[model samples]
Target chain A: MDTTSTHGASPGAARAALLVLADGRFPAGGHAHSGGAEAAVKAGRIREATDLAAFCRGRLHTSGLTSAALAAAAAAGADPLALDEAADARTPSPALRATARKLGRQLMRAARAAWPCDALDALAAARPRGAHQPVVLGVTARAAGLGPEDAAHCVAYESVGGPATAVVRLLGLDPFEATAVLARLAPELDQVARRAAEAGRRALTEGPGTLPAASAPLLDITAQAHAAWPVRLFAS
Target chain B: MHLDHSHDTTTAVSADAARPDGTRRALRIGLGGPVGSGKTATVAALCRALRDTFSIAVVTNDIYTREDAEFLLRNAVLPPERIQAVETGACPHTAIRDDISANLEAVEDLEDAVGPLDLILVESGGDNLTATFSKGLVDAQVFVIDVAGGDDIPRKGGPGVTTADLLVVNKTDLAPYVGSDLGRMARDAQDQRGELPVAFTSLTSGEGVKPVADWVRARLAAWSA
Candidate 1:
């Protein structure tokens, strides 16, 4: 029952910390971004809950899986700088890469305040511009005493959750329907998290190059187009 | 694993007094009000008035576009590099109050790009009466409302009107044309804010931003002291 001994507790006891990190309102600057939902919505690809579901499903399996794997690897103690490079390689659009790093720097700021670990500080100092959000998320999980699975789950959930929330705003879709979309995706989300965590575990020994490289070409192309728009609701 | 020591990064966390390099950071002042309330105009005027006296920069939170930042740049109040624009995803209040990460990054980037700044004005996008800047984001806040918006806005007080460090009633020149009673607004504002100060301005006239500029100068004096 000693409060000072809490750090020594098992990851099972750190469920609250995981929730804190994974919460949509973590103040890590994710609110300003639509996770490509804006671009898809503008292109008439996400007009309703069904389209949103399909879009999120596609994203979750491709870029989402890749990001989850990168996060998991970082959480499993893979080199963050290398993971950052891998994230850059996976992202074809320069615009998405900038968004990822911007979000990463913001996440680093919040994580340093929330956890205050040397590892997070080192990453922040090393990449003053930013180090890719998935990498930062993994390192943040490690700092918060969570494991690779927890980090992967966070990335996997965020992959769809961000778009679903954004579509509700852009299309004014039913909030309940949006919630249901995420509810339906929960099973796939778990699978993605498990696969990502497995890859992350392998990455701990094989290096960050071993992480998954799922890609969504349409998202990359549309992101570049979205960035050039003179007026848009989301940053990326 | 909790590390006891402070972070070694150069980025200052929120309103930290000193930069990590052991130099004093600039004092941040936030400006918030409803749309068309002259928040950007006041920011531009403040920069013009104070730029000669002190190193200054601006961080503008625009709801969707870079209009505010562009306005400042077009006026040439401060150099292009001294201005930064942050997108708020249609929630200016959230960027200024709830989730201030983007705005914080803007301020930190400004300081890094142009350091030794004496002041940085954080301007919130035109929002509702309830919007207010977080204490962590700025040392003080100014809530601006135009006489044209309605003199009754003072009586219909919200967080911005009641708790802001300073309340500015702008566009006094339009009061007669709009049929807004300046005296009533002044009295109601006094009632809403017991001892807090208020400034009435008409930026169309020469030296109209003087009152707000004086208030900022006083705040800077106290911050430097």
Candidate 2:
């Protein structure tokens, strides 16, 4: 549970690297995904800002927490291959798994170019098709010299940020409102990231199974349905 | 050329002339334009014209549907496996210009699947004049605008019209019916592009794609050289 150990060797430049990795426009193939927002919007689960906020909150606590912990574990120097398997075990839907791998492969390409590291290369060779995206993201953070907390924060933010951005496109919800939804979730994001980082620290000694495995069944169910849509805006 | 010091890694970076295996990658050319400006038609026509001479693959960034990839597939200009479609979320420009990771993946995957390719055509979903491919994504780009879209488009001179390696004024056959001034369009394009080339074509007419195909051949030649 000692999270500070992960940050001991991180340079001050790691902070800027975190910003670069967490930027919405980081070019890691996230734009095409809706984080289940599309399925929720189409099913009438999310109509306006309030519904969107609720959907994001639900996602944040479940899949977001799980993914953040996996990422944090990877960033804290957990075996990426093992963390990838743990991610697959936590993700129930095959469609989501495929999406994660596809995005992971894309991110691997970008990460290798941006920050060349042997760990990233080893994981890439092991899972050329891709490891899960959170696993890849954690390794990417490490390659960029970031800490486990930074990795956790990136995944936590992306969990809500991806859908909020997509909702602006799907429902034509006011961009300001969508952004404000994210702003409102910031404190919760911090808590989740902190918890995820703590779990990641524990996993270094306890094994990857110690990481969070929160599940949002609805998201898993809707993602499969979303993948089958012949005509949809987002890939996931 | 951008150099990578980590040359031992297997990952492919954007616009690298050589592949990870030390072979030359395909010459990637991007086509971008506004909605219904015949970008897909140009791609299909180019595939038909150049497939005999070169190993060609197409990557279509469809904004919503896979219509562009389907069009090429339906036309049978190239085999189905040679074409890859990328969903652009909602913003076609962002996929092409702002963030090109997906497109680059599609391009690299195509090369891996059907490689030793000579040319790879990346067609952007129809977008506004501001849309253009990033330099990191394509070696060159062709911006297609038609006579029907309005003769004034060239005069407007956005990044696509002004800065693309080539400007294609499509649908010349419709000029008479649409009451567009081809001469003025050409002049405006020349004025905007300086010494850069512009091709006028009507895919409905015989050998309409020849001029564009010839331009592509010259580019391919330069690339090979």
Candidate 3:
């Protein structure tokens, strides 16, 4: 598990390592979040597979693209602190920011243990609370011998995967249907990942401001509302 | 087979009880079992019995609410600052076993809030027999099942029944009233977990939590050794 390589290895080797990093069961605390699906379900905006697909598609281009770019930038060896600030700026909702940091801290814990990198050590010390999550994910992907494209793919998949799984729990929708929704969106996910990775590569020269600032106003508002709820299944 | 009780707060995913500076951290013990099986009661009892001798904190994983954590706080089992609740998003088992990131965060938060504590008891929300804590989250575990749930629970041995570090058959006073067979339960537990200790407790009784508390003391002693 020599994770120090910046350029990583062959495509086949990269895929195998990516599988481990992108696994849904990576123990990164993504399970407890609905990524706005819970609020959507409660608001009657998302009821079945069709609504779920639309919701995921909307998220993919908006906050999902933003997160993917941040991750890809980190994987591309961008400064995590600057990327973290970029994350905070892109995330308007204070509640979402808190959720990002909390999940960031949790992911950092798992990544530090799994990869044991010095770069993770410095970030953990600097942000004892946590940096933004996608930054950590990108940095973790880098430490795991993955590249910007790999990190982008991981973020893109997570963006929709979390909401789809959460809908299954929230609506009791068929597990097969939920999985099919993800499968249906796979092509779009790939496109988003590629664009995100490209943007990340450009950010190295153009600056962090060159990154996408796509926002979903509804999601930001709903996430804030969801945080105040006294009783809810998912955290956000 | 002496365990490395050292918990590195920085790189820990599971039960790393040593802070990065080499000083020993708290011994984390998990209590898990079926819904309504007195897991919360046993945790409260353990806190009551051990708080005098050990500086302690508690982390509770609740399915939908912080009821378990609130119970401890209401009872003053430990101070409010010493208690933390992890919302499990309706999956207690996932938080404790499959992906323990939230629980790890809660435990570490408790340690950070409180001082260099001697013990931290992590109580799982009432879950089925199949639920158990991951080794990454707790130093040791106690599977708590009430005799009232069924004496057959031990006989129908699942992972928690067969392999927990300690199996606590709680609410023994209700055994006769509920028509549960205590002797048979004891025998079945013995068969399921050979050489591992089992404690039968009625927390209402004065000395009921002593045996489990003694076991915890021994574990703490060994951890500090």
Candidate 4:
């Protein structure tokens, strides 16, 4: 699965652009969050590398796929406001909703500075409190001259990558082992991204209703519970 | 729904001279130091000392919990609305130095919520000697180290020790017990920092936090002028 096929005429330059956007060190405030891993760790669900892999795999199929589809739709030039409402409909927990919007606002600040697009400006103006993060991610990808598939990959990777890094700190799981878990899941990540992009392409014809609606109940419940915590590590 | 163009349309990215409405934003000063160096205590003292003259707010970057924020709140240093706690996800330095998106959001949110403020103190979680505030996050920074941590900290200068706008050597009251040499530490700091300022303090003393508070007032005056 060669995911790094440069989209533009200048293949090398386009490839480099993808690298910059997708790099974990992009400094978009993803480091402070554990993508539900912190909750799982607190619950004693993830103890070692294997448990982490299983947890990540489950999240990848659910929240990961959903975020990927929304991102792909945004990259394909869908309406961000409509997608934002769709995001709200999917996210049941108020805490998760707040987290999504907060992260979205922070991401918008960084993206606007990097890409400097009128569309992003318009979106930022439209949702001053911030839109859903996946919607913003897709729009940012579009601003960077990337396509739906690239946006899908970006969200999908972040789905597992965030948890992996966080689990390293939370559980002291071997960094090598956590990274290996991601490496092992690369093939599945590719599949999820492709399906998300396909769904995104369909969204233009049908509507945002065509996008995937996958949810993990435990994750949602735990996220709400975690927000009430007086003391916790990750923000979400 | 269009955002109030006057409030939200800030075009300048880095720590700008003015808010989007073209009014001068509050002067932001960051306090960073090693663990147990009394950065929070200093912040509390500063708030108690300067709140009468300035509309003050605080943002604390804590690694795990909201301990620092809770400390200020419990002490009643400022009203609850004037305080914000940012979670750094165990990477204290990242929030202050490397990727400052979270800290920027906190500061801006505080300003938007409590407008027309005069000063905002951004307190970093206790970190290593290398941690310093990014120019984008704060206009100036103070590095705090205590004699108990080691009088040798100044001699082994890192970015925070050598480059901060103000370096505070705290807990001079414990110098004798800790076998720390205040004079030698000052000399080493001078040798390392060449014209930057340093202050020795013991929070228990009446005038302990006075120098740092006065320094902040001077910065605020300069910022206003």
Candidate 5:
């Protein structure tokens, strides 16, 4: 992803951006969430750090696909509205749709002052239309003048980080251990983002690729169960 | 609206809207607080109080459900299509804060679906004291706390109480029943918010949502002006 600065970009600017985007404390409202790890873990889909890694890998394939598609589209500079619909149509379960929108909304907001891109600001104004996190992530990165590679990395890192952050809270895994797991995943992240950025570049000329039409059935069912509860730890 | 102005950030009206562009980009407001803090009720009451005077749309977040949107739809609080729901998968805050793409899309979609709306209310999913909307998400935000959470909640000052554009201490009607003192709560809130406005309401009794709605109206006027 060539964000390494042959372009006058500095390590300080990158660190500052990371502080705003990666710090979980940036006030875009991430604290209330457990990043779906709680529900997945409760459903017995994950058990240990290995399971956590595996679950993240699966997500990189499925929900991860959903998010990346949107990000890639936005990076190619596609229509945010259409990207949103493509995502909405792809996410069938009402629960997942809501989740996407909520996070999508927060991402848009946080990106506003921090990233300060016209696309991001315009997206902020367009609401009630619904959005996908990937598209917003792409647009935000673009707004910040980060190239496709940086955008891809941000998407992959945040996607991986969300669940890992949740696991630390849910399992009381050592923070250092969690950091180790995340650090280990960096290579895979680079691989995924690099591949995706190429795909994104191709799509820029192709006018955007189609998304997977089917939503995961088991995911919808679990969300339904979680929603009906009167008392629960996670908001979603 | 025509949405004539074009920029990378703004995805203007779809190909079909009749109104001209650059006419009006609706004012957006966000409402947030702990769950059961009367967010829906505030939204519902706002619709009832102000719909006739302004064009409005709603975006409601539910962590794993569309229950808030459904509630509005069932009550016919607004047209079925006007109210949209955002699901925050793990943490409600992430949708509103960390990963807000989806919610932004929803708000924009609602504006596009209707036309030239004057206001949009993004209701955050129930959350803890720390939760607050990103200024990027909404032009202004309303943090909802209630007497039931404890009269001390205001005094315990969190960002929601201290920094939100407006603060609503809901469930004021419960004060007598809960042995809570509303005056003390109001004073504590006043101490925390300084020149910012605060309102007390009992959504159940319909005691005081109008002032909050009016507060919203003023901000919308200020934003659009």
Candidate 6:
């Protein structure tokens, strides 16, 4: 499934496109966390707006970027098999990797049911065990007929999905404040999506079987410790 | 690949009444309830009962691991492909109630692969009485409470018990041993639901799921019609 044409949708369709992509109802496992906001809260890392912003921003760049890049590449109609390997290499923490794949498989199940595309099967069958979140996102995006930008934003949204939910639960913050946080951060949405799209293009533009690997040990270490805790509110 | 085309009404052994266009949506039903109240048994039984009636699929939500899906597969309740797991990695309530994206995706994928599906059941992992299926994740929901959980469960008035499309009082066979009166539960349920229906069953003995299945079948008919 090397298909790669997006039909050059009109600008007027952009709003609808964003709506479909950003709609919390898209069903890709974004509801599982508060973007590490829960973990951050547990760690005493967040208590107010400014702290939440920084934590969300950092996560947006790390695991968030890794997953988004892979999804974007997938949306571009790249090989899911290749994307899986690439995503696996970038997610080094065993616990985090496992969580990513768990979410990935769950995401795949929903995406396959909602939109029947060869890419979905390709992704599911690509690996003997489990595929990574980015790969699943990328393949699903393509299957859904979304552009790379939509794929890019979808990935960024995943980062926020979990953390945003955590905030409401953790702080008892009103939903209005949460939306305000998201609205103020809207500028970053375009920026992060653009970068993610570029990263995805780079991963796919490389030779077949070639992929990037995880660079941050801090995340892996934190995930390991987080997993060992007796009680944790988030998966990782 | 529209949602309306019906094709696998008879031939497809995997799913008895799947739609024709493989690229369509799965019919989603949700099972939610309190902890240790036979939610797993209900899910396994539904898979067995409906596996031949539709292209059946399941998504299990365990708090920390993919245990429930593993349990069903280990018991051979459904094929490995037909069973997937979602580790909520959080409160079980969050996945089913507040945030439902992951569960929704699983339902869609099952439909995508062996679809157009007749049904896909999302099993909520054991949790407190507050757990209920999100409207986005399921077309209709079955709230499973059991005699073991106590007859007061009916009067507890959680959204799951009062508002779910169908309410199931499981483990009726254990009522005598557990000292629960099914008649009292019926009265309490009636007091809360007004017109919504409730069925009492003992999954351990396979005593009462037929009515639940019939209700589900009727919903599927309406969805496809």
TM-score of each: 0.95, 0.95, 0.94, 0.96, 0.66, 0.63
Q: In every candidate, what fraction of the native interface contacts is reproduced?
A: 0.59, 0.62, 0.56, 0.64, 0.20, 0.30
DockQ for each model = 0.48, 0.49, 0.43, 0.59, 0.14, 0.20
Q: Which ten residues in a row have the lowest lDDT in candidate 5 chain A?
A: A2-11
Order of candidates by DockQ, top first? 4, 2, 1, 3, 6, 5
Q: What is the lDDT of residue A30 in candidate 1?
A: 92
Model 4: lDDT of residue A35: 93
- Evaluate model 4 with DockQ and give the value: 0.59
Better candidate by TM-score, 3 or 6? 3
Better of 4 and 6 by DockQ: 4
Clashes of 4: 0
Local accuracy of candidate 3 as per-residue lDDT tens digits, A1-236: 23355445532246777888789999889999999999999999999999999999999999999999999998888889999999999999999999999999999888887777777877787787889999999888888778889999999999999999999998999999999999999999999999999999899788889999999999999999999887778888
Greater lDDT among 1 and 6 belongs to 1
Q: In candidate 4, what are the lDDT values of residues A38-85, reduced to their tens digit?
A: 999999999999999999999999999999999998888888899998
Give stretches of model 2 more than 4 Å off. A1-13, B1-7
Please list, in the order the candidates appear, how each scores on TM-score for chain B only. 0.95, 0.95, 0.93, 0.96, 0.89, 0.86
CA deviation > 4 Å runs, candidate 3: A1-13, B1-10
Question: Which candidate, 1 or 3, would have the higher lDDT against the true structure?
Answer: 1
Highest lDDT, which number?
1
What residue pairs are clashing in model 1? none
Candidate 3 has a DockQ of 0.43
The better-scoring model by DockQ among 1 and 4 is 4
Query: Between 4 and 6, whose TM-score is larger?
Result: 4
Report the CA-based lDDT of candidate 1 relative to the real structure: 0.90
Cα lDDT tens digits, model 4, B1-225, are 222642236554758888766788899999999999999999999999999989999999987678999999999999999999999888999888878888888888888998779999999999999999999989999999999998899999999999999999999999999999999999999999999999999989759799999999999999999
Quality class of the docking in candidate 3, CAPRI style: acceptable
TM-score of 3: 0.94
Number of the predicted model whose DockQ against the real structure is largest: 4
Angstrom error of the Cα, residue B80, model 6: value is 17
What ranges in model 5 sit over 4 Å off?
A: A1-43, A57-159, A166-176, A187-236, B1-20, B97-100, B206-208, B220-225
lDDT of each: 0.90, 0.90, 0.88, 0.89, 0.71, 0.70
